[model samples]
Target: MPSGRPSGRVPTAEEGKKPGARSIPPGLAPRPRAVPDYVVKYPAIRSPRQREGYKGVFQDQLAEYTELLGEVRTAQRRLRETEAAMGRLPRHATSRTRVSRGRDSAFLEKQQRCEYLKKKLTHIKARIQEYDRDARDSAVYF
Candidate 1:
């Protein structure tokens, strides 16, 4: 035993937690407390137009937004595939050591496709970002 220390088997972090500690994390909402009877009797009115944390995108407009998000994801996947295909395209050199017609044409086509996809992706992402921000505008308050 050391000075000002207890002589016992010490607990490790994985084994157990000390007293007055929470095992699991709490959510963003304030902890529940015993509300005074008077306050409860005269509780304020809160208009719940939507559910808390509407990650589900429950609104009608949000349904379209969700679909658009899915499309964006699909487009991103296509873009990656296109870029990969571009990389895998074969390069044939002529006797003068110049990149041949077949490779050049294939590479240009792939490059153009990639550029178009990139621009489209950027536009869609911007729109989705604005929609996300709009969702955060309205709120429920105390």
Candidate 2:
């Protein structure tokens, strides 16, 4: 004669788990992507408005540099043409002073423009360094 109770009813490990195992809440929202280091390093990081201003300044400087480069190239081509013409002249004859003066003026103007561009580039680089330092300091707190 067998007992009325079931003979083989063992609870599996999974079946004996607590309700809390399935009810745990998810973690906090995902963190935002980090800003690039170079951008943060820009001097504009001092303030939002300053950052915008620096961007504008940097763009302007870049445009000026491009223009200066073009002007320098044009001047160089003209100088080369003038030199070629002088070479073709008679042995005793040379390019006139007026022609030389014009070339000199063009060269000087191009040189000045290049110098100005260099100065502006240097200033922008300094500002960028300042901005980067500020950004790094702020990031430490974050």
Best-fitting candidate, measured by TM-score? 2
Tens-digit lDDT string for candidate 1 (15-122): 687677765554765778975433433222232332222222324334554565565556557657765665676654223233242345545555555554454444
Where does the lowest 10-residue lDDT sum fall in candidate 2?
Answer: 36-45
User: Model 2: residues >4 Å from true position, as ranges?
Assistant: 1-45, 96-98, 101-107
Residue pairs in steric clash, candidate 2? 41-131, 41-132, 42-131, 43-131
**lDDT measured at residue 98 in model 1 versus the true structure, 0 to 100:** 36
Question: Which pairs of residues collide in model 1?
Answer: none
Local accuracy of candidate 2 as per-residue lDDT tens digits, 1-142: 1778776878886678887685344585566897644444443345757767777877887887888888888778887887778779885685466466345776787788778667666666777677778777678552
Best by lDDT: 2
How far out, in Å, is residue 134 in model 1?
1.3
What lDDT does the true structure give each of the candidates? 0.48, 0.70
Supply the TM-score for candidate 1.
Answer: 0.30
lDDT of 1: 0.48
